[model samples]
Target: MVRKNIIISSLFLGLVSASPLHLKRQDLPIDSYDESVAAGADSTDTPPVGDAVPQNVETFDSNTVAAEVVATVVDTPPAVAQASNDTPPDVIAVNLLKRSDMNVARADGPATSCIVRTFNGPQVSDPDTPGAFTSYPAFSTAAIDSVKAANVPSGYAAVPNFVNLNAVAQDKSYITYTSSKLTSYDPKKCAAICDATAGCTSFNIYYERVPLEISKATQVPDAALGCPGNADAASATLIKCAFYGMPLVATSAKSVYQYQGKAFKVVYAGSTAFTKSSGPTVDGLQGPVTFGDAAINAPAPVIDHGYLRTQTFGTNVPFAPELCAASCKAQTEYNAKHGTNKGQACIFFNAFVIYKNGKDGVFTCNYYGTPYGVSYAKNRGQWDDSGNHWTISNSFGYYVPGNYVAK
Candidate 1:
């Protein structure tokens, strides 16, 4: 794919309505990997600023990049309050690295790998019911075991690369949710749905306590007509599956308020989350290596060691690291032909999904001239006072092997 040069004049900004929730950054043990390269006085290592013009480059895939800049809009629940800060809002910022290179291969199909986990939680029930709502046994385990005991549904075979991420349903970046009345409580089925859905990378399956019917009145035969606010209205259990566009993390699976009203208190039980094991592969790149949940934070080998360019992809295009690889490769070729860089080329790149206000909105790729290891992957994300919460997920870095030998 060939792309036209994209001039990045200024950082794009947008507003989102959400309560402020800070996520602490996770620290990872670093392995000893020296990425130092000799720097000369003439080398330009300073990172690019807002005025920098970036070259729009093509990816290995035939998918066309969106022609216009895309803005992501987050859906806010009515029950949540808008964010408020005691101090002035922090400026939205992201650290960027210099140029890099990698070759990427087109993916054949949706990721086939998957994993599953079981969670022990309490079920929701009426206080006046025959039995009390107690701790639900390993809900996921029982569900999987029951499925195994019965005939396997056609096309619902286990995904080879599926892996479990958390014991609870993730509360972020959900596209939409449906109940067992529409589908089933089968993880395999949910995985299949995510595989087929564009931009869906993970899924959560659980049982939820919901009102049989919503009514405003206090006394009525059928909740469909009228039900009192006595809180004893009949409740039903729904096997719901929520799909997300990014990997699910246990940290975001916080079990707080699930949605409660005057007559009903919705609660979740036996939640489990699954994510894709890997990303698209480039032939020469050393990785699609996981950076845990952070972006690369490599120090400049030289003064000129900052990122060559940065590109953003909206949710319409699924997270594809190969696009970053291709952009890195393209930047190198452009530099060579123009005799711009003294002898440097793009040697590494980082790609990840960024969630805006709890929804997967942007897929970002940053190209670098110096290659760094996972130890440098420290920048997680930040919250902007604009009421937009930024979070990083499924971050990976790709690098070309060998030291930077300038041509």
Candidate 2:
């Protein structure tokens, strides 16, 4: 009975110890063989005991590592670059590089001290002065062709002061004057008189005409645009005569300026109320238009920007920008047909207009003459990098920089 109890205990323990694989491998833990396992193997497709066991896996490769590394790098943030420091930090000093030489009134009776302000036309000429403080030589048409040539330093002696701004229109047409005489040449009043009067188109506002006492030569008046300095006497009366027909617009401009150029409608200089006359007298040429009214309906003139800002193709503005830029054709045209009806082709465009009018359905561009524009256009091809690439221009002119568009 004790032996039987031992056997039962052993069987229970073996059952407890047997794993699933062991149970599947064989009905009994031990291959007590006597049951003929070989026969069972031949009869079935099942494995017995530990035969045909499973094995463990070991290694991998390199491409997978590289792919994982790339993924991680792509997920990370990139480094930021540095910023530019061109702009000033708050308050900073800057030089304007521009100076106004307006010397208001001098003892020489306003004739010798005041700066010459308003005038007609783009042509400027300074009479030859020999022993004078400044001598603007005999200016020919060639000088007028170059705007840089026209850019006389501000307050340049040729652009000197004037006193006794006394002007007179004699013979109902001639512009003549005496010292401190007329006492007034109100440009506004003159404009009014022009509007009221039919035959009137201009007024000879007076200022002292001081000639450069050119040695071995003749004294002459400084005339801006058209009138060149010739042999004339000190008794010569200088008059500023302006005419009509332009409220033209600008297409664009360049540099530190606002898009629209500065414009002052009134022709004569100074306040609206005062008109002083100063100078000597002379005759011959179309004299000033005559009328008594003190003011008129005159549109203001735009002050043009005198620089160039074109690209490899042409001017920066797409509209009528062509009107205001420089060109080789300007020189050619000026040299060619100067004596014709068009006279001189404006070398630079001081002003322009670009728009379609409902009345006309067409765009209009005008190149008002510019002393600086002409000069810059001629020289720009050498200095402005973009200017050299284009074909030689067959037109005349120069332009303003900043572009202005109004819808």
Candidate 3:
């Protein structure tokens, strides 16, 4: 009986050892085991006792045993595991922390500052009222003579014809004027301004006495009691640079006037003028004769000789007649090479200034194959479809004289 009992105990122990209670090694797929090992889980390690499967993982079943086992065995936090589905856990945490810190920093910072400023307009002064001083403090006969001796500025030469008109207290036709109150008494500045103006051909520099205050008294013929004019009022001397469309002439300088008797004399002094003499000169071109305010309207030389083309210049380029002459010569040469008809050569050109709405607009050059006399200059101007009026002035004609053969 003892032998039989011992044998029974031995058989029971062998049966318990043969059939283990836990899952068999082969029951979990080899691929699942390998994946679990790849995810920081050792093949020899097992899930902690009583550990629940992550909520993000699918429910365990016979078909999904390997995947569920992998989710269970991998040492990952639930939140990190969920986030790892779309992005790396470390990257997600870092980006979220950075955005939160930036928001908090902006909320705690100071507000931005802004500023606005306003400016007042210029004051208008009257030229007729008298001020404190009786005469100009800066005026002297020697200074006037010195300015006359230095007739022209550095880049300009004296207009030999109008030298007699210098140092005269007269106002001529001017397109515009700049006061020395805005700048210094500089003739070079005036010349530069004239060079930049579209139709300015000359400039006049002068000193004029202006009153300091406006007269509030009643207008009376008697000069003693009431403010008749600013002649006797305290005055300020202003140097004026005036630009003109044409050269200075003796006829235009005869400006003489009196206001409220001669006690308050509005006098002018230290008057000087200048004109631009430097320009391009073309050979064999004749007659830059003044057409006054008209352009050439000539008939064709033959059937083939007539109007060629028109060119317009801007304010930067001065009214240069040689530019038109050069273009005419070029056109003649081009026709000699490429023209199909005989006598089809550009032999003449008209240079003028066009005024738009009574202001200088552009410098124009019109080319023609045939020559026209100044008497034939009949085109003043006309109106356009847009109702903008254009008129021509300061026109001059140039031509090749004595049988201009195209070669």
Candidate 4:
């Protein structure tokens, strides 16, 4: 057996929402790894103000779903940070290295850097009845492998990836009201489970921790507990998957339940896809998207070191900050060739993974769909405007066409 020792670091990114219950920056703890990657510099680290230009970029899979926006907190590392480094179940660890490697293959993979498998859900017209629990399908490596083809609608994209959430207390109204639980919960199959059930819309996948009691009947040895002579110890956690079609409204009775139990962590919260009459659109297609310089003011929602969106672009395309913008420019033409309704054209562009090589700090192009949201300059400032001076990095200057009409 090839023992794959997966090391999941506890690296979490913060999220800010446009909702009333906003996520503060402090709530989002920073990680050293992310900072190192963001801090890398290249030749165009800082471009002169007004020198940066927009470039064409490609589109990514997108849907204009309602923004419950739990902020799929991208976990930089896996949740199970065990000291013993025991090999986890193969199904759980295989997709842990979720992002597609630009260095190797570009075949179908997870939508985000986080790896969570999407499955072909049973197309039930309605969720199963209330008070009735359903079992998630058994784990199958073959079933997972079949869906690994690119550009196909595998209902998997509907699943959201959340990191480091606490387990839910069973007494919580939402959990109590949910009433459906599945043993051997797999986050990868969350989408299918929710869809198969009647009235089901959202679900939470989490690990449930239980305490070990060393009574006469249940003799847990010290070696097993990792605490010799300790009467009380916690047993290894069990993962539980809960499904709910109802919205977790912020009422007086419900809001408190969010923080109540040891089982309160949330691995993923999935909802129906974002709906839009038309697909994602570039808000402003400004031209001459420049490369490398210092900035007067940069836009919001910057992609400093996001995982490369696709393997083809990352491997075949040379490191060019303007590659995404160039892809965006040719989008209209691409759309003409491949039906605008198809939404195959690139909607957003980014240049990431900056590194220094001699005089120039080089970076590569990445494409994306409509982001959950975007930020422009405040107070009518077009610092993010085209031909404006927006800082890319300290060493080199690059700009992502910030304006987008996301779904």
**Best-fitting candidate, measured by lDDT?**
1
All models, RMSD in angstroms? 17.5, 45.3, 41.7, 24.8
Clashes of each: 27, 47, 8, 59
TM-score per candidate, in order?
Answer: 0.50, 0.16, 0.38, 0.21
- Summarize candidate 3's per-residue lDDT along 1-407 as a digit string, tens digits: 00110000000001112422121111101112112113221111111111011101101011122222122213233343223221111100000000001111111222221111111111113433322111232333322442464745655654443332224322212344556223544667788887666546667665554333322221122334333334445444555666664444333343443343335554455455676554323467876666767776555332233655455432222355665665556556544654412326777777766655444334566666667777777777766567756667667777788633221
The model with the greater lDDT, 3 or 4, is 3
Stretches of candidate 3 above 4 Å error? 1-200, 204-236, 242-283, 300-305, 340-343, 403-407
**Tens-digit lDDT track for model 1 on 1-407?**
23232211112221122422121122111100001011111212111111112211112121232211211111112112112321111111121121132222322333331111111223344352212321444444544553352533333332222222223443323444444223445766666767666556666666555454432221112333343223565555556566665466555464533333354444555565666766656777776677866887544332244434345543333465655665566556655554333334878877776665554335667666677677777777766556656667778777776632221
Candidate 4 CA-lDDT value: 0.24
Candidate 1: segments with Cα more than 4 A from true spot:
1-134, 138-172, 180-184, 214-224, 227-230, 258-262, 282-287, 291-306, 309-318, 322-347, 353-364, 370-393, 399-407
lDDT for 186 in candidate 2 is 35
Best model number under TM-score: 1
Considering summed lDDT, which 10 consecutive residues are worst modelled in model 3? 91-100
Clashes of 2: 47
- Scanning candidate 2 in windows of ten residues, the lowest lDDT window is 3-12
Q: How well does candidate 1 match the true structure in TM-score terms?
A: 0.50
For residue 142, give model 1's deviation from the true position in Å.
3.4
What's model 3's lDDT at 95?
A: 5
